[model samples]
Target: MSVSELEPGDREFERTPPHDIPAEQGVLGGMLLSQDAIAEVIEVLRTADFYRPAHQIIYDAVLDLYGRGDPADAVTIAGELTKRGEIARVGGAPYLHTLISSVPTAANAGYYARIVRERSVLRKLVETGTRIVQMGYNADGADADEILDRAQAEVFAIAEKRSGEDYVPLSEIMPGALDEIEAIGSRGGQMVGVPTGFADLDALTNGLHPGQMIVVAARPAMGKALGLSTLVPTPEGWTTMGALEVGDEVLDADGRPTRVVAATEVMHGRPCHEVEFSDGEIVVADALHQWRTSVAGVTAVRTTEEIAATLDEVHVIDGPDGRVTKIVDVRPVASVPVRCIQVDNTDHLYLVGRSRVPTHNSTLALDFARAASIRHGLTSAFFSLEMGRNEITMRLLSAEARVALHAMRSGTMQDEDWTRLARRMSEVAEAPLFIDDSPNMSMMEIRAKARRLKQQHDLRLVVIDYLQLMTSGKRVESRQVEVSEFSRSLKLLAKELQVPVIALSQLNRGPEQRTDKKPMVSDLRESGSIEQDADMVILLHREDAYEKESPRAGEADLIVAKHRNGPTATVTVAFQGHYSRFVDMAQ
Candidate 1:
């Protein structure tokens, strides 16, 4: 009978789990022979990953020495073991010499480490299976669903352990953290993480850092949508959605020309709608298409569907001269092919149709993701809980190529835009920026995916667009509790991954109630834990967003309300709404 058919007490089932003693010896020997080998092997095989007890002790000693910037050869490793009174337990110094002699060459240390790690994983699988079998036997009256979930958790635990979630001594972390701080200081206070592309903000917060949860909160209508087939204004002239290409230049919400950095392929069979304005202008778009509107003096970006819900409310259209227009009617239209594009403007808006009506683009997370990958050459992962992957990609492209998002969404492009995209395409394409637009994900799922990305890509950054959309996976008493749980879990995730996590958040109506209309740390919706969990909190404020003709029309305030490691200050940044990005005010 095959192994699966064998009983629990069968001889085959009692056999030793998978392991390779020779491979473990080879790895230990290589590490002893060359200090460089230690660096390579350590990443693949942790101390517990070794099959033999002696090897585990040896591995730990070697790592301790290495972390302290000391030698890890036979003599040093033996001395380290001796200090812990474990020298004899690890077969003494002579065993170390024997290991060095056993290895032919240290050059294949990584290969040897892989062999050891593989066997360890197989051994873990066996252990996990045994535990699951026991659970099944003992789960007599327990809920079947609970037992199943417990079994699944047991299986997934292997992956979690392999992801380096084991507790580490403070000794191992302080060196790296201090070294990083010193390096930043050496650079005369240069940013230590992904650059925000805004100098003052970079100086204030030291960039969007790793293992951090950055909250960019604002009132509604701050950003995003567009469908295909909408006419868009361009420097070369107006163009149909189907005619637009990457690198095409188009006018932004400010009526300034910007390039299309990214454009999506035609999406067919989308539910379409026709929105009519008071000026007798009609634009055909999908329900997801966004429009800049003002209701009772509160200007915000609203989707076609949202606008349709309140037909009686006066909707003010986007205009440079502060002209207000009302929505006459919104009716469903025939399904049609739709396209989307993103530009490099900070305001992330562009004009559509002859009426010069303005529409929106998305967030700052894509900009940080793009900067981390293309500018800093670091791998980054963006978890877009709201937008789709295509839209996220287009936004990144827009930020990188200095193109306008609305222009690209409407498929309005000019030759200059294409040329600009061409210049940046190679960098953008090669960037280690991974986008996952999976919607309504739980924090547990995000952790699992982020762990995998961390292992495979050496992921350095994570950006989650808005936190409230995330679920706690299990049922909670209230939304606030769920959000609070997510907030705490996100902090743990950042620490576990050792990378910064930028989680976009929505502020409560507290900002709208204030005359200044500035958000505070207390405004983080649904949870007080969000304020406690975040290493930094950035409240995004634009005077022009509240006051139509303010003197600071194009300026944004990045209020660093809470900086765990540094001083909190408000950094003024230029809101290049047209280019879909933020720049230093001097720019």
Candidate 2:
């Protein structure tokens, strides 16, 4: 029969039964009058709500017998009940068989639980329907209100049972009664320091806490990827991870160049007597004999793409003479040329800065000014004035002015204007502000690389060149939803990593539509959640770039769109195109 056609009593009987009264007591006090008395007992047993205490006990007993591989037939059950003084005699065998046949088999433990859990609600609804029928309500005009009331009452009872104790006050408990400090101290102390460039940011964030995910997002051509690259660290005198040139020589274990050999040339039987893999695999090749041997299997792949595609597999390829060879697996073979440094070590300081401007101008000046302002502001705001007020002075010059300054006499006041600015900034700030110009990167790849760096070196801070060029790995009905999820993930990563992730984002097309072209928080493209998620959001606008200017062609306004902990204000900074930098205005 269909589930809906089954009577409530039949469904409930499959799950659980009601009380276990003695058979002697059943015959006393006119309880056992006729066949109707037996029918009444059967009906009560079948329709008992399993969620009630009495019903739950009987259900548990039935389930326990089933678990023990006992048949749940009425004769077996009646005998058990008689032994417990619950029944005086076994019921008619034919009637018992009918009940047993109707009982649903508990195919799985979860299925049995669901049946028992649903019995109470189903029985109550059936009773409400019966009552409405007796009250002269036509089947077609039955009031749903009574059924709903009964169902809600059962639900409320179940909810009440599940919702146990109220919350306890912390003040009432003894201090550290649970010994939380000792428990935490028992585990290895937390690792610290994935650095983002800001000191206050670092102080609040604790320098890129381990096991944390971070996103460096930026607009198209805003150096988001370049900013992430700067986080990777290399040994002193070695170029950082993302520098343009691959050094002429690969350093050996002893930090000396063994030789310069291309992978293709080596594979084509060009002699390499001493070829060492970064992971300690050795290759010995005799170019003259066109033969090669290695303790570890040596294989050669034609391209990096081939290697990447088979990265997860056991890659073996045919060598020049059709000899089976094992390929040396580079731990990190860059899919694209490393435009950003990957800092693996947490001990040394590293900075990640991203920009929203596609060109170098937006990132350079904002980064320089930000670094300078933070450094000088910390010194001036925190320490004594008498200790010699240290300030990071910067001059933003256009391409034409830079050319004119270069033409001036060496060491002259005019020549030193830009030089002095650079020098003063260097003196005030602990590290030089570097610029990144690379574009779009997938969020998964970005998180993977950031996590790797944090594991290797304990990264302190991560800055994105910008947020717009970031690819959210989501295919949604709306681009707005995709961007919203992406923004939320970035904030969650920052909080989870306990580091300040400063991402540069683009203003919406609405700004371009306006006459002034000034940006506000509303200009945050796609999602309003971006504004909500960010600890701070800054909008970079240069009025002179859009409108005609007289003298200060290099000035730009920085609007602090949203700041969680500080006042929102607009600051004017000088933007230089030539040096690819920004400077704080002399106040």
Candidate 3:
């Protein structure tokens, strides 16, 4: 009967309708079990029941159709489901399609995809015995909040399971993916290698690799810049991009100032004279003669502005100092473009050296100094003896045998002691060593340098001469902030560069307190980042230098205050006053 035809209270109060009897049992009762009945059924079948042959066959068929880019229709799905024996009732095929189709498309698709993607999640949710409210017109009177709470709990359980501990090594997951292919290497034919400038230094470090930020640091007269100057090519072979400005006087490699003279004037006797024409062209005869001479081409125009509209390849003038006489049409030169390689002139070297400055900030300098001090302390204490011997061998007497002979003749040390030191020094000078002297290098520049070096030349060792001298910028207000920034920058740079950045640092007046006089990490000037960032720290202490004509003579103690990678120890090295170098201790 229609709702309008029936009187409001005419029906017997509290009496159940005839159809409600069957509806309360079996399928009707199940339909009333949940608001999202279809989704609940799908989730149940997808996880818990999927392991059953029937459920597996049905899910595989449906996923296969989806993967094959075919539309899933009720009839096809019913056939697939029936083939898998998931339906037993005679009319189950049509009944299942009706049930599936009756579900909201958005809700059904989302639920199905989630169940498929995260099976374990759905399994955990179902195991929780979650309650759900029915969402059909027939079962409109259901507890929505209870249903929502149960569903949320189930999903949360599943999420937890999915995020549980699991580990996978990169090697097993992806094989041969990262293997290097040399044919596709950068810079064409440039082979990656190490720099073998010293022996003991190389022993501790393999060698200087390309693209590393090596810091070579020292106090005012420690030969920091001189050491850097010795690395880059001098005299010729290097090209520069910008203008080279030497101090007021320009000097060649021999320290002689060069005088500029016109090439034509040198080649020819007289200065080149010129005559201008009405058509905006000039003709010239050799006046001040030069090495090269040619009046190639010119352009003619009525207005002055048109004169600039000429090709760069074509020569527009008669000669140097020669006047334009006639407007002549000429084809541009077809010479091949020569790739200009920058020559490392004094100015160019300065610019390259300057580009390594780190940012002007507090955290970086402190970190850089701390790292440098630690590195210096460790290397100096343990490897200084070897470094000294290696330096002498490479730079002076070509062999170990000659070191003892020279030591005897020079009266620097006893023959036996010198021989023993030389042997020990030679053994230690085999590792790689790299030094970067850039003022304040940025992280990007440091990383780029490291990566490029590794990729292009496979270099691993690096060094940076004295840390404090490295400038971040002129804007830094306090020396503490500047040093802190420098320190952090160096640490990050060392880690990124994947090489040891041995930075030299200055000691504060604290060293003056003790008579023994060896600087400590606390003695690092200005910033504590040096202590925080360095893997090692070494202090060069000379007791004789403090006293005038002291009996200790040429002995210097390389003190190891911090060693992040190894044991801390002190070593004695012979300090040569004449050459400003060090030598290993006699055994």
User: Which one wins on TM-score?
Assistant: 1
Per-residue lDDT of 1-587 in model 1, one digit per residue for the tens?
A: 77778887796576988999899889989998898899898778777788889898888888888887998898888888988999999778899999999999998889999988888888888888888889889987876655665565555557655532457779767977898778878987556777866677777777776678777765433112345545565655457667878888886643457888888777778778766543334566788877878887798999989998998886767543333345667777678777777888875556565222311113555566766788888988888665667766776677778886555665666889889989998988998988887755767678778877877788899887767557645656977887887888789778867789887776665776677777799987778989999998888877766565468867778889999988999988776654567767775
The deviation in Å at residue 254 for candidate 3 is 34
- How close to the true structure is residue 278 of candidate 1, measured as C-alpha lDDT? 38
Kindly report which residue stretches of model 2 are placed more than 4 angstroms away from their true locations once superposed.
Answer: 1-357, 360-440, 550-552
lDDT per model vs. reference: 0.73, 0.39, 0.38
TM-score per candidate, in order?
Answer: 0.66, 0.34, 0.32
Q: After superposing candidate 1 on the true structure, give the runs of residues whose Cα lies further than 4 Å from its correct spot.
A: 1-13, 23-45, 58-114, 128-165, 171-190, 222-361, 389-398, 403-406, 409-430, 471-475
**Model 2 worst lDDT run, 10 consecutive residues:** 379-388
Report the C-alpha displacement of residue 230, candidate 3, in angstroms: 18
RMSD each, Å: 11.9, 26.4, 27.2
Model 3, which residues run further than 4 Å from truth?
1-447
Instruction: Using lDDT, give the best candidate's number.
Output: 1
Candidate 3 C-alpha lDDT tens digits along 1-587: 76556676754323332221111112211222233433344434332323233334444445444445554445665676677665553245555444444444433443443444454444444444323223223346544443443354344335433322246557433433333334326536332324222233333433333223333221111001111112211122222222232222222322123322211111223222222221212223232112121224223322211222332322233311122112232112112111111223332212111111211111112222222223222121111101222332332222223343223333455666566657645443532223333323543344445444544443444444345545544456776787677777667655543555555565554665666555676877667777777765656666654443346666666565665544666656665432223555565
lDDT of 2 at 94: 46
Model 2, position 353: C-alpha lDDT score: 24
RMSD (Cα, Å) of model 1: 11.9
> Order of candidates by TM-score, top first?
1, 2, 3
